[model samples]
Structure formats: structure tokens, C-alpha cells
Target: MGGLAWLTPRKRSATARSVLAGEAAAEAARKTEHEHESEFPTPGDTRAAAFFDLDNTVMQGAALFHFGRGLYKRRFFRTRDLTRFAWQQACFRIAGSENPEHMEDVRSSALSIVKGHRVAELMRIGEEIYDEYMADRIWPGTRALAQAHLDAGQKVWLVTAAPVETATIIARRLGLTGALGTVAESVDGVYTGRLVGEPLHGPAKAEAVRALAAAEDLDLDRCAAYSDSANDIPMLSLVGYPYAINPDNRLRVHARENGWRLRDYRTGRKAARVGIPAAAGVGAVAGGTVALVALQRRRR
Candidate 1:
């Protein structure tokens, strides 16, 4: 134990440094981009907002995957890219955790696919895709929760690792205040195939909320956050009210231990299944790949 004593502190220091860096990056993003605030102003509470996770929390599947499916339908990415997305989806579904390396792979692939596309073009398509594929997938319970916050006059925001464009579209459609998502670098309204910072996942998510709270003059103690995976524990811990909605096993345990509220919208059989098959097989060709790969191996 003594031999490893020096390494423990060094690791902790490194982690602390990484988290601080993430916060700084998110702060910069907030300043550069204008979040889409609600048009209908609320007068009840101006100092508090609710931050919600996108995938498996506000929707049934990964928002990014759904966006990828739309891109695939529009021939934005080739079959090769679809295969990688499927593998990543399978991995994410099975693990039920935000593995940094896995998310990095997805980020890199998404950037490459949108390298030369115009931001406006993608946003237009995203709207269409959301209507066709994502609109009905939203959980009625979760929708009601968000509506309740809106009815209370508190702003509601979506904080997700999905692309900012996609998240913003969803927020607007749902009549939320705004969304904070992974920003992709663009030049002249065209994507440059790069990110402004890290994906808004895990610790970075907490950093984003902190930065936004400071900017908006929001009271952190009055804020609330909701998510499904334990990966968002950092973000969940930032707010006064943290809810585990459709929580994974680890999050379920953590929420119970912390005396947090837990809500599960899925049945026992559905909960046992990762539900990656649909996301993995987003396209006809990818569907066949999922069939052969047997990603449902996790259900066993």
C-alpha cells in the first residue's frame, strides 16, 4: 500500500485538473453560443432551472444515434460509419455507462461525417428526423415532469452529450428554455469536423451547469437535474433536487443511498433489455449487422 501511496495523489490531482479544464471549456462555449431561451416568458421563478439528460432520460434511445440515423438516411455517412455507430451503440447499451473512450470514438466519427456540411442544412434535416423518429419516443411521464417545471415558471434546459443542434431542436419542440450540448466547430456556417471542447458528459456536465448557473445568476440550491445513468452523478449532485429517471442499476443504487427520488418508466422485461437493437439497426444494412452480431447478448 505504501508503494502506491504516491500514485494515488497524483491520479487524484490529474482528475481534478481534467475536471477544471472541462469547466473552463464549457464556460467558453456558453459565452460564444446563444442558447435558445423560451419565447413565452415565465414570471414565477427566474433564478432556477432544471437540467435534463437527453438519452434514455427524455427519450427512449440515444439522441445522437437517432441523429446518426437521420444522417444515414440522407446519405451523409456511408455504411462503414453506420457499422461503427452500431458497435458503439451496442457497447453503450450493454455497459449502461459513459465510457470516455467510447464516447470519443462516437464524437470523432460524427465530426468526420459532418465535416463539410452546412450547419443550417443539418438543422433543417434534424427537425424532419425528430418528427419522424424521435417525437413519439419521448416518455409521457418525463414530458409531464418537464411541463410541470415549465408550469411552475422555472426554466427547463436539456444538458446532453448529443450535438447542440439536435438538442436545441428537441428543446424548442418541447418548449423548454434551452439546451447545452457538445459544440462542433464551424467556419462560415459550415462544419469544420472538430469540436469546441469535450462532449458534455459526466464531469463536463457538472461544469456546464456550474458555468450556466453563474452566467444566468441561477441559484444552484434551487435547481434540479435528472438522468438515467450513474455517469451523470456529477451533474445530478450539482443541483438541490436530483432525480434518477429510468435509472440504470448503478444509478438506482446511488439514488437510494443518497435518498434521491427514483422513477422508472420501463417494465421489468424492458428494463432488462438494453434496447440497443433498434439503435444499432438504425438503417436496413445496419439492421442486418445487428442481427448477425447479436448485441442482445447482454439481455442473457
Candidate 2:
């Protein structure tokens, strides 16, 4: 009986030692895994960046237009206001209007509509609107451009004047590295209808790109910038490769004067829009149709 009692203490000590050893091994393995993860860089960690503007640069029209339409449908904005907004935007498009007073009025009016809405509510609405309108509205050529950058192992970012929540949703869905956009401020969960930072447009867009480049250690000299508007001239000038995708008249003139490459993705050819051969257009249409069908099937 005494021997059995003496052996019991040794057995318990051995069991305790085994458990302690197992725990130590597990902790060591966890630490090793964490270190490995830290060693590998994510898509956003690249030293090269491809900055893309959201409106006519990536899609055919302004993202704000679609967002406003969605808001109108949801009763968050009045139909009459939406109509007026659309008309004003159309005029801006046609005339290349950069009147400060007109721009400020539009911005103020848009912000006033969501003055008291909760951030969570607005975010919910954004998600719903994204699924309904924004997702399918991605321009045919924009996704291909983004994918090409990804393939080249470059970090692709969406820079826009659209609200951050809305832009982030689209960026994430497209597997972009990151996004920078205007931020609407909230106080105690409700919106105050003011921006947290400068509105990401014109020179503001260039500033955001600079800040992002510095933070991510991206080399501006090796980066690319794409936009369709003359307002993006500052942003385009900041990068090594400035591409005008479906450029407006002003931007097209600037691009031509600077000998920058002009691409018309809408026509799906490497040639200028004015001189595109009929055969090339036919080939582009056929190829685009096949690619789109393949994309739809892949999504399904």
C-alpha cells in the first residue's frame, strides 16, 4: 500500500510534465504561424500602385448619379431633386462646366438630404443599392484593366468623390487593394452632413493619392493613373503612366498634346476612335460578346 502511494506521486508528476510540454509546443507553433503570416505581403503591400478614378474612368457615368437614383427610389431623396441633379450633371458632362458655385450647390444639396440619418442606416442602404445597381454598372473595360494590374502584381486602388462606404463596397467586390474617397462624418451614429476630410475631387484626389503613396511606400514614378475627365489632370500628372480612358474633349486634347496613350475601351481596339476600321469594330464586338458570356457563366 505504501509503494502504491509512493508511485502515485511520480505518475501525477509525469502527467503534469506531459501537459506542460504539449502546451509549450502549441504556443511555439502559433507564434511561428504568426511570424510567417507577417513575412508575406498582401495585395495592398506592393510598392507599385495603380490609381483609378471612379466615375467615367471606371464606369460610363458618375457613381453619384446611380447612388442618387437609388436614394430617390428608396424615398431618402425627392424625385424632383433627383431629376434636377441628373439634368445638372448632364449639362456638366456636355459643356465641361467647372463653375465653383454650381459644384458647391450640388454638393451642399446632396449632403443636406442625409443630414440626420444614422450611419448604420446609410450603410445598409448603400449595400442594398450596390447589389441592385452599382454591381452591374461596372464598365466593360474597367474590370479588365483592374485585372491586368492585379496580374502584373501591382496594387490597384479606387480613388473617388463618392462616399467611402459606397466606394469601399465596390472596391472590395472587385478585389481591389484599397480605396480612398470622401467620408461623411457622423456624430453618435447619426450623420452631420459634413466631410471628415476634404472631398476627394480635383486637387483633393491628387492629395489623397500622394498620402496613400507615402503611407504604402509606393513609388509614384512607377505608378499608373487612369481617368476620363480633365478635372483629373492633376492626378494623372502625378503618376509615371497617365492613361486617358474614354477621355473627354479637354482630356483628349491634353493627352494628344503630351503624346500620352489614349485608349477607347468602349470600342475595344487599340486604334483611335475616329479612324477605327469597320473590320476591327466587328472583331471587337464579337470578342467582347464572348468575353461577357464567359464572365456571366463564371459568376453563375
Candidate 3:
């Protein structure tokens, strides 16, 4: 009876009517199955999304390294461990996070050190660390770009390999939609010293976005994505509008080859290096914790 109500009298023969109704039902069932498989709504969502990679893409540098410094200052780990972390962060700065080995090492060390730490205490530390080390490091231009997406009513998400707690704080501070990061397994509200899965990077990052899209009914074809490193190419490729921010050599070449938009915030380094004042020094934190912790090795 769904579409059969529009039948003309001449075409309403009992046999024809049954066949027409069956065809209509079959089409409807096919559509519903497709929607379920793709996780798309029947009419599809009108809202779009913008996914931003953290670290060099949004902030100026490696975020976890900064948090490591806060933990080190609190005596969370030994001076030797901090030194090792600092060296890894140095590589991240110079090599543009192309080394999955360094990333996994940092992820392992960070999670391991947090074992047995109370979740509430870490959250508090995260808040304090951001205010002191991360708040000012955010690039004004990139921040405004995020705001533009928010203004347009698009969901703005931060995708990073850092812990979910850390990512949530950053997104909240910037009024972003939310964030997806590596999850550290916990029991009884304390760290278990292990990851629930692999760190979100490369193809893993794209998978995470697709999972989010399915959960939120987002349309990737209408979405936009931004990142600064070549390592994030998989993630950028997942969307229709892909922008390369402060892209490295590999990323620049790739972007150009694909005709992707590029934004270079590195020029701000000039004003930052001019010895202007506090305002200009904000750029320091881009490499702040990552660089300083290397020199801080002798503290112990």
C-alpha cells in the first residue's frame, strides 16, 4: 500500500498490483541495507566536518613531549628517561614525525610511566600543563581556521596520537567538537600501563576517522581535513578538501602533485626569532618542551 496508492485503475490488476508492491518493497529494503552498511542516514546528514591533526598541524610541535616535561618536573620519571624522550622529540621536530619507531617508543614510554597513576591526578596535571606550556603555543592562523569551521557549523575534531584525556582538554580549550587519540587501558580508575590499540597514525588515523564518521553519520565526501606532516597523508586523503599546513618537504611535494592547498606558518619564526618580546616568544613553545627536555637530561 505504500506506493500502490498512486496506481491508475487500468493498471490495478490483482497480479500487476502485487508485483509492483513487491518491487517497491524490494527497492526500499535495498536502500535501508545500504544505509546501514555505510552508516549513512536515509537522506544523509547536512552537516559536514573538518578534521585537524594536532602537533605540527595545530600546535607548533609534539604535544606528548610537552606533557612529558610536566611529568618530569613532577618527578614522574628519572632524568635518563626524560633525556631519551627529549631526543625522540628532537627527531620529531627535525624529521617531521616520519619515523613510526620514534612514535611507538614515545607512546610505550609515556604509557608505561603513567602506570598506577590516578586518572584524576593526571587530568589535573594535564590542565596545569596546558595553561603553562600549551596555551600560548597555538598558532593564531590555524586557530582562526578552526574557528571558521566552527562558525560554519561544521564539527571540528582534533586527531592525534596523544592520550584521549590530553586531546579532550586541547579540544575543549579551543571549543572544538571533540578529539580521538590513543586510549590507555585502565582498571579501577588507574592506568594499566598499556594501550587499548595501536597509536592512531598513518592508515590508522584514517581508520579512526572512518569509525567516527560511522558513529556520527558524517559524510567524508563533503568533509575537509588538515595536517602538516607527510605521515598524515592517509588521513588527509580521506576527505574531499585536504589542506597541508606547514608541510614538510615530502608533504609539500605530495601536496603539489595532488594540487592540495598549503599553509606555511613557519614564516612566523622570523618574528619569533627577532627577540621582539613576550608576544613573539609564544612561538618558543612550538619547540619548547621538546627541545628543553633534551638539555634537561643532566637534572638528575
Candidate 4:
């Protein structure tokens, strides 16, 4: 019996070696095919550009919410406090009050909850959640818009404040060129809950877009930018064509004041109606909800 056991390991080792050789050969073939495909660009390429926001613009809700929920389920956060934290976020979204105190509270709480956790574990959890929930949560209209840009031979970039790793995964899934997002700092494979650079939010989003534009040689005046919040004003203004999709109260006001075109694809209809003025410079009030227009400048 001992002799048989020793022989079994040698047999298994031989089988493993054979399998690895086959895998390596297959991988090399796949790489060759991929390289060939990348060598050729499709004909009739008109170099236009488009920028999309992550939350509410491309997705139905904030990615952070789901990530937080996943962390809570993993016992990283107190189960009882999770609900309260979610409620606060909801309030912040609705009010657009920009309460630094509340923002810090949420940030610190989330950090405290996730402290000492390995980055790999969080990433694994995020991946599982993304496949099951995050991917499906994409807004239909947003997807269509992104596809249109790709079809038009335009470059599409996703500008977000989410972690770069998470954003990059989504971009790859969508077949986008790349993404610009906040990068979380890591030390020894563990998260520090601190950003490596500036958070890609508000004006910072615009900065990232500018950097991409310069790197890709994109014409900002000919590029299109889309967002749902007034906080995105810096980014939206940077592009020649600015679009406000399902905007919040502040953004609705800014859109109308700026004469930007409005679109609501949530109902699957191309927005065709100009919003009536609610307050000067603000969008028309509709059903107690604000509807702002998007702006696009014709290519001259």
C-alpha cells in the first residue's frame, strides 16, 4: 500500500506537467490572435470623444452603496448601523446640501468598519457582487449612449469617484478604452482607506477628463460630457457638448441657465421637449421632480 501511494504522487505530477504544457500553448495562441486583432483599426474612424459619469449617469444607483452593503454582510460593519448610514446617504442625495460634517461621518464610519481587511478579500467580494448585482444595475439609456459613441468611432471614457480597480473592471466588461476614477491607497496588500491621489469628484472629475483629453489628443470643444449632478458642472462645462441626464435640483437649475439640452432615457424616449422655466436659470418643475436639459454644440 505504501509503494502504491508513492507511485500515485509521481503519476499525478506527470499529469500536472502535461496539463500545464497544454495550457501554456493555448494561452500563447490566444495572445497571438488578440495581437493580430488589435493591429487593425476599423475603417472610417472619426475621432470624436465622449465622457460618462459612473453613478446615476451610467448606473441606477451609487456603487458605494452596494459595496458598503457587501461589507456589512461580511460583518465588517455593525448590522444595526448599516441602515442608518444608508438613510443618511439617501438624504444627502436628495438635499444636495453638501454637508461636510455628514460626509466625514460616513467616510470615517466606513473606513473604521473596513479597517484591517485585506484588499484582496474586499476585491473578491466586490467582484462577486458586481457579477450578481452591480452589472445588472446599469441604466439602460446610459448603455445605449455608450454603445452609440463606440459605433460612431468615438472614444468613450468613464469618469467616476469609485476605486480605480473596481472602475477598471467595469470598463473592461463594457469594452471601454479605459476609466478615470479615485484610486485607493494600499500598503502590503492591505487597504489604508486613503486615496492615492485626489478623489475623482466634482471639479476633480474635470481635471481627470482634461488629463485624458491631453493624453488622447481629444478636442475638448468637440468632446461630449454627460452627468446627473450639478457637482459635475466643472466636467460638463469642459466639454463643448454638455448633457444633463435626470439631473438633481441644482444641476437642473444650472442646465436651464446654461441652455443645455435635456434628456431622460429612463422612460426609453429620447427627450424632445424643452423644459419650461421653473425659476430663472433653473429647470422647469415637473411633478415635484426637477427635469433638466442636456447641451450639445454642433461640430463646426
Candidate 5:
């Protein structure tokens, strides 16, 4: 009955109803934040935790894009969906942040891809995908930083807009505390293709950190955050120690202005020779992906 409440509501578009439903799911996560504690004991500094962004900060490229590729290989989605993911990945790799328009398309397509899929099935595949696509892409410098936090007896979490299941798998693989990511709505262990709240991006990322902090009895002044995009400034600002890792242009400038510490692993001759052209190539492919997505939808 609760899930069907939207059916009895006053005038609301399908998009609006989806948003409202997601918000309700997010509220539930907030209320239960405390219960989602790290299974590993924090014996050293229990009040502090380090939060790392998934893309470009911890991993080399878009985590979702990698996941999508893995899913595509398994025939979980059609070729058009994969193309859309490639466009998003390219934009992210080049600009170092999400394009709002692409993100909306991605959100819709991502939901469509998972509709009617079992949660357990996705989780099982996600584990394999991580080993195949993500394991080698982790930035060693970022891994060490997270390790330092763990050594200090503090929790370390990955907070990203990627699906929570995927994020959790990465955290577990890395031997970190846990992750906070966008939730996909599920019923009877099957995905309903709707999100739980918004994707955990931008201001929403900060909000999630705050909720987790409150729930885990963490001190914001003792916590830290790392990211590669200016879009994450809100989350970065919330921590006592903020770092810009492999930052894009806007983030680099903003970090300098704010006196946030910056680290760039993609330096030296190799990056100079190959990086710019690679980024440009990625940005150029978005148009084709968008067209393909539209065509696929029409065919359906």
C-alpha cells in the first residue's frame, strides 16, 4: 500500500513520482545510518573516518562505466546502453565531473537496464566485474592514503554516485570500512528501476557524509575527504583535511584558492604525451552514444 501511494496522489508527472519515491527511500537510509556500522572494529581512532570519491580519485576512470562494460559483456544490457555509458565515461574522464544532461540520461538508462533484475544477481556479477575491470585501475597513491587511515584505526569509506552495491564491493575488495553510494530501489530482492533518493553526487554527497557522521558518532573536524572534481567541493568542505587528487582544471584552481592540498599522479612525460588527445577523443564520442540511445528507445 505504501509503495502504491503515488497512485492516489494529486497531479504529478511520472518523473515527479519517481523523485518523491526515491526521497522516501533516502529518508529510510538516514534513519538507519547508525545501524550500518563498519564490521571491522576501529580500535585506534574511532571518531574519525576518511572519505574518498570513487572516480578518478580512487579509481582511474568512471566506476559505473567500467561496471557497465562488464554488464554489457554479460548481455545484461543492449549495445546502445553501453554506448551511452561510454559517452558518460568519456565526459567524466575529460572534464573531471559529471555533465548534468548526460547524468540524467544515464540515470534513466541505468534504471532501465536493471529493471526486473534480481539484486543478488547484480551483486554476484558486480564482484566479478570488480576483479576484471576495477582491480588494476586503483591509484596506488590513493590506496596508500586509505591504508594509512586504516592503520590509524579510523574507518575509510568510498562515497560516490555509483550504485551502492558496486561501491560496497570495491570497499570490501580494498579492505576498507565501507561505502555510501546511490541506492537502487528493490522489492522482493528485485530491482524496481527507481533510485533511492538522488544519486549521491554534489550536495547530496555532503548530506550523506553528515548523516553518516551523525550515525557513526564521527567528528567532522577529525574526518577527511578526497576527490578530483570541483563538484565535490561541498563534501570536501565538510572535512577537516581535504585533498584534491588528480584534479581537473576547475578543481585544481579551486583547491589552490581554498588552500586544499593537491596531488597529481598523472604527471611527467607520459601523461603529457597521451592525456590531452585521449580526453578529446572521449568527449567527441558522446554525440554518437546519445543518438544510439534514442534509436534504441524508439525500437523498444
Candidate 6:
């Protein structure tokens, strides 16, 4: 009892005050959480849009590769076609598709086979291809983000370099607003196998969004865009909110410099399994050494 001098009235008062302050903070936190429960964009009903870049953003891998598998199974081409495409796919996955040469090469090769086929046939095959391959590959996080935008009453569109048929199938399956993709000309409902314009890539993607915005009366300042590749910087820049999901190297730097938000959905195990050697964007950033390594592993 003689050593109890420290337990004065002041000390007891301070302890009670600390307990009350903690309770007050907890109550404030609960109120904030309740207020944000419906915090997604739709409550204001803005005339905004959500643009998503397909390939590696929504799906884990190349959309064209899965489309090629669908085409192959339907005998739209031969075994040699698959071999050639596989080689191209390996180079593409390793080197990345932002390179103009790579994009042109891929476009030329794909268009050559799609020529002279019936539009209906390709559309049917696209449905099957998406169900069998693409459906499972959809990233849950990206999907949720898109759905959030849709719930907010903003338009959600998938932008890709894939064929219109395949892109449409994916959009319809996912219940998105629409999709913009490379257009292959068809004559009398049969594939003429020629492109109406360039592949919707790089700057072209931005242009497409602009066209859509003009047509749909959307305010770009309220819009949002998401992508994985540095190639989509043009498109991302067109929006108010840009998310670099699973961003590549060049994109990572750009996002950081511009103070853009980023989310990484690619787990370490998948990165290791893919033999990426470094971050997904390393090949695009450091040197072709990483690209060479990735290509070699894919070959195996």
C-alpha cells in the first residue's frame, strides 16, 4: 500500500479517457464503413464509361491462341497452321505484343486463314472456343471491377486486337456493354479475309474509344480504363481513372510516374511457372535477354 502513490486520481482519469477515445474511434470507423457500403460510381449516375483491354488483363494469356485452338479443331486450317501459330505465340508471349512488327506479323498470319470463311461459321466456333478456353481464364478481380462499373450504370466495353466475332462472344458471355476489335471484311456474309482498317491497337485503341464516346455521349473525364500492357498507355491516358492491372515493365514505370493506381493479380507461383525470370514487364524494360529466356522456356 505504501508503493501505491502512483495510482492517483489523475492516472485513473487518464485511463478512463483513453478507453472512451478508443470506443469513439471504433464508432467512427463503423459509421464510415456503413457510408461506403454503396460507394461504387453508379449512385451519381454519371455518363461515364469503363474501357477494358482484353488479353492478359481480363484473361491470363493471349486471346488469339485460344481462338486459334478453336479454329484448329474445326479444321479451318491444318496442323502446320497450329505449329506456325504456336511459334508465333511463343515469341509473342515472350517478347510482348507492343512491338509494331509483332502486331503486323500476327495480323497478317491470322487474316490469311480467316479469308474466305463463312461469318456464321467463325461466330459459332468463337462461342465454343470461349466456353472451352476463355471462360475459365477470366480473372475474378478484373471481372468484379467491370461488374462494378456496370452496376454503376456506366458502359463497360472490352477493347482488344482479337477478331470482332471472338470479342463479341467474350463480351456477350461476360455480359458487358460491348466490345471493339479488329474488323475483318466479309462479302455477302462470307469472309473476304481482308481487314477494313488497322488492328485496334496502341493509339488506335484510344481512337476507337473516342469514336464510341462521341457516339454514346460519354464524358471521357468520368471514364475509366484498365490494362496490363504498356501498349495501352494511349488508351489509359484517355480516361480519368486508369488501373494498371498486372502491368508490364514499361507500364509499371508510367503508372508510377503518373501516379496511376495499380493492381497485381498474377501470383508469384504463376510468374515462376511461366518462367518470367522477373516481373511480367521485365522483358519490355530491361533487355531482350529476359525475352530470350522466356521464349526458350516456352519452346520446351
Per-residue lDDT tens digits for candidate 2, residues 1-300, read 343365578675544433333233223223332454433224532677678888766765666767778889888877779887787578655553233455556667768888999878877888888888778767656677666666556767787777766776677667776566676667898889886544567766776777667655788877878887788898899987787766767887899899765656544342344343324322334434543443334335
Deviation in angstroms for 266 in model 6?
0.7
Report lDDT per candidate.
Answer: 0.75, 0.65, 0.70, 0.61, 0.75, 0.69
Q: In model 2, which regions exceed 4 Å deviation?
A: 1-45, 92-103, 267-300
Better of 3 and 6 by lDDT: 3
Which parts of model 6 are misplaced by more than 4 Å?
1-46, 95-98, 269-300
lDDT of 1 by residue, 206-271 (tens): 877888888778998888888998999999999888888777878878998999876666555555
Q: Global lDDT for candidate 1?
A: 0.75
> On a 0 to 1 TM-score scale, where does candidate 2 land against the true structure?
0.73
Model 5 local distance difference test score: 0.75
Q: Judged by lDDT against the true structure, how good is candidate 4?
A: 0.61
RMSD of 2: 19.3
Pick the winner on TM-score between candidates 2 and 3.
Answer: 3
Give the TM-score of each candidate: 0.80, 0.73, 0.74, 0.69, 0.78, 0.74
Best by TM-score: 1
Candidate 4, residues 192-279: lDDT per residue as tens digits?
Answer: 8765444566656776776666645668887788887788898899987787876666777798899885555443221222243322
Q: Which residues of candidate 4, in runs, are more than 4 Å off?
A: 1-47, 92-104, 266-300
Task: Say which prediction, candidate 1 or candidate 6, comes out ahead on TM-score.
Answer: 1
Task: Show pairs that collide, candidate 1.
Answer: none
Q: Write one digit per residue (lDDT tens) for candidate 5, span 1-300.
A: 355466635433443443443344244444333355545555676788889998888899888889889989999889878988998888877766667677777777878888999989999999999999999998776787777677667788888888888988898788887787888889999999988756777777887788778767899887889998888998899998788777777777788889987665554542344332223212213422432343234335
Name the runs in model 1 displaced over 4 angstroms: 1-38, 94-97, 271-300
* lDDT (C-alpha) at residue 224 in model 6: 81
Give model 3's TM-score versus the native structure.
0.74
Ten-residue region with minimum lDDT total, candidate 4: 287-296
By the TM-score metric, which is better: model 1 or model 4?
Answer: 1
- The clash tally of candidate 1 reads 0
Q: State the lDDT at 13 in candidate 3.
A: 52
